[model samples]
Target: MITTRDATKNDIDTLFDLILGIAKFHNQEEYVLTNKEEMLNSGFNNEPKFGAIIADFNSKVAGYLSYTWNYSIWNGCEYMNLDDLFVWEEFRGQKVGLMLMEHAKNICKEKNISLIRWEVEKDNVKAIEFYNRLGAKITEKGIFRWHLNASN
Candidate 1:
C-alpha cells in the first residue's frame, strides 16, 4: 500500500535525494543546485516558498510530489504548480505515482485551486502518456528559461 504525508523538516535529506533522483533520471543533474538546507527553508519555513508530499510504500520511501502556489491574472484564484512527481524505480508500475497525484488533487480541492501546472521533459514519453491519461491538455505555448547569476 502507498501512503503520503506532507514533507517535514526531518524529510529534507530524503527529499533532496528524491530531487536528485528525478534530476538524474532526466539527465539534468547539473541543474540541481539546491541542497537539503535550502529545501528545508523553502518548504518548512514560516513563509514557505513551496510545499511537498512524501510517498511511502510499506514503510519505505517511494516517491515525492512538490508544488508551489502561483497567482494568475487570467484566473482570479490561486493555482498550484506541480514542480515534481517522481516514483522510485523499484516502486514503479505499482501506482505510487498515481497515489501521489491523487494526493495533490485532494490538496488542490481543499485549497480551491482549479488548476495544477507542470512541465515535463519533451522526451519523457511515458510521463506524457500518464498525463494524457489523466486528461491534462497539452498547450502549444512554449516554455523558456534563463540561467541568471549575480556575477553574470
Candidate 2:
C-alpha cells in the first residue's frame, strides 16, 4: 500500500536522490539544477522555509513533493505553490502521485490555504493530463519570471 507523510530530516538523502532523478529527467541546465546541499540548507535549516512530503510504499520512498506558501493580492489569501512533485519511474502508474497530491490537499486545509498552484512545462502532455485529472485547471494567463544577478 502507498502512504504519504511529511518529509523530515531523516528523508533528506532519499529526497535528494529523487530530486536528482527529476533534474536528469527534465534535462535541466546545470545552472538551474537543484543541489543537495542547498536543498538541505533551505529545508532543514534553523528556520526552514519550505516543506515536503514523501510517498512511502511498503517502507520505501517512492515519490515526494515540495511546496511553499505564497500570498496573492488578487485572492487576498495564502495559496500553496507546489514547487515539485516527482515519482520514481517504477511507481509512475501506481497512485503514488495521487497519494502525494492528497497529502498536499490535507496540508492546504490544515493551513487554511485558499488554493494550490503549480506550473507545468508546455510540452509535458502527460503531466497536463494528470493535473487535469486531479481537477486542476490551467489559467489562461502567462507567467513572467525575472532573474536577478548579484553583479547588479
Provide the TM-score for each candidate, comma-separated.
0.95, 0.90
Q: Number of clashes in model 1?
A: 0
Question: Which parts of model 1 are misplaced by more than 4 Å?
Answer: none
lDDT of the candidates, in the order given: 0.91, 0.86
lDDT of 1 by residue, 23-107 (tens): 9998899999898887777789899999999999999999999999999888887899999999999999898888899999999
Per-residue alpha-carbon lDDT of candidate 2 for residues 1-152, written as tens digits (9 for 90 to 100):
99898888878888888777777789863645556677788888788889999998888789999888789999898999998899988889888999999999999999877599998888889889999999999976688988789976
Tell me how candidate 1 scores on lDDT: 0.91
Backbone Cα, N, C clashes tallied per candidate: 0, 0
User: Per-residue error at 66 for model 1, in Å?
Assistant: 0.5
